[model samples]
Target: MEVRVLPGEHFYGFLRFYGKGITFPKGHVESGETYEQTALREVSEETGYKNLEIVKSLGVVTRPAIETDGTEVIKDIYLFLMKITGDDKGKAEEETEWLTIDDALTRLMPQEVEFLKKIQLEIYED
Candidate 1:
């Protein structure tokens, strides 16, 4: 479930295959480019939403993954909560829709579900 927020609300990406997933519009970090910069670029490319401000870092999670060819790799993912401006104008690259937090959570991966719960708790504390 790729989650994007607008002001007081959040939206999750709904793809047919993945169900709902919080995915970053991500790319390989270019030379000398910070992860944040790469994130912004990826968001625009994947979703066509360009107006964003970083709210906070959600830290990183590293996990082992296997490629289709059976190559093992360690995947490091950096996460953040971003506030988007304007209406939903981005062209979705998949069969996607904006979902409520509760609905999205039901479809997310287990780790992602836990992460979002923690993030929401932190937000309430703020």
Candidate 2:
């Protein structure tokens, strides 16, 4: 499942980042970029918000990815506390929706709500 942690005034919004079937803002350490750099770039490109920052490492998430069945993979997604830059008015990119962090968590099947709680408390990672 794809996930993005977004900043809000009183709390945060965890969103499902994607375009059609593709989750555009996936975190992959790019060449000549640190993990943080990768996070910033990916978030900016996908969300049009360039002020993303890695507040902490949320740990490595591994799963039997649907795109690659039976092949569990490990991904290093550096979770950050980020603020959106600029007005999102009239932003044309599709395949995204503004969902409450709670709702966003529920969007993903399985133990999604439980996982969201971990991030809410910063419990699973420091």
Error of 2 at 7 (Å): 13
Compose the digit string of candidate 1's lDDT tens values, residues 9-92: 656543334543444344568898888887766655566666766666777756566777999997877776655665655775
Candidate 2 has which clashing residue pairs, if any? none
State each model's CA lDDT, in order.
0.61, 0.48
Model 1 bad stretches (over 4 Å): 1-9, 13-16, 19-24, 68-70, 87-96, 123-126
Off by over 4 Å in 2: 1-24, 66-76, 88-94, 109-113, 123-126
What does the lDDT come to for candidate 1?
0.61
The sequence of per-residue lDDT tens digits that candidate 2 reaches over residues 1-126 is 122355432334343444312222455677799776776666666556544545565554333344346665544344555545444433323344555455556555344444456676563232
Error of 2 at 81 (Å): 2.4
Number of clashes recorded per candidate: 5, 0
User: TM-score per candidate, in order?
Assistant: 0.69, 0.58
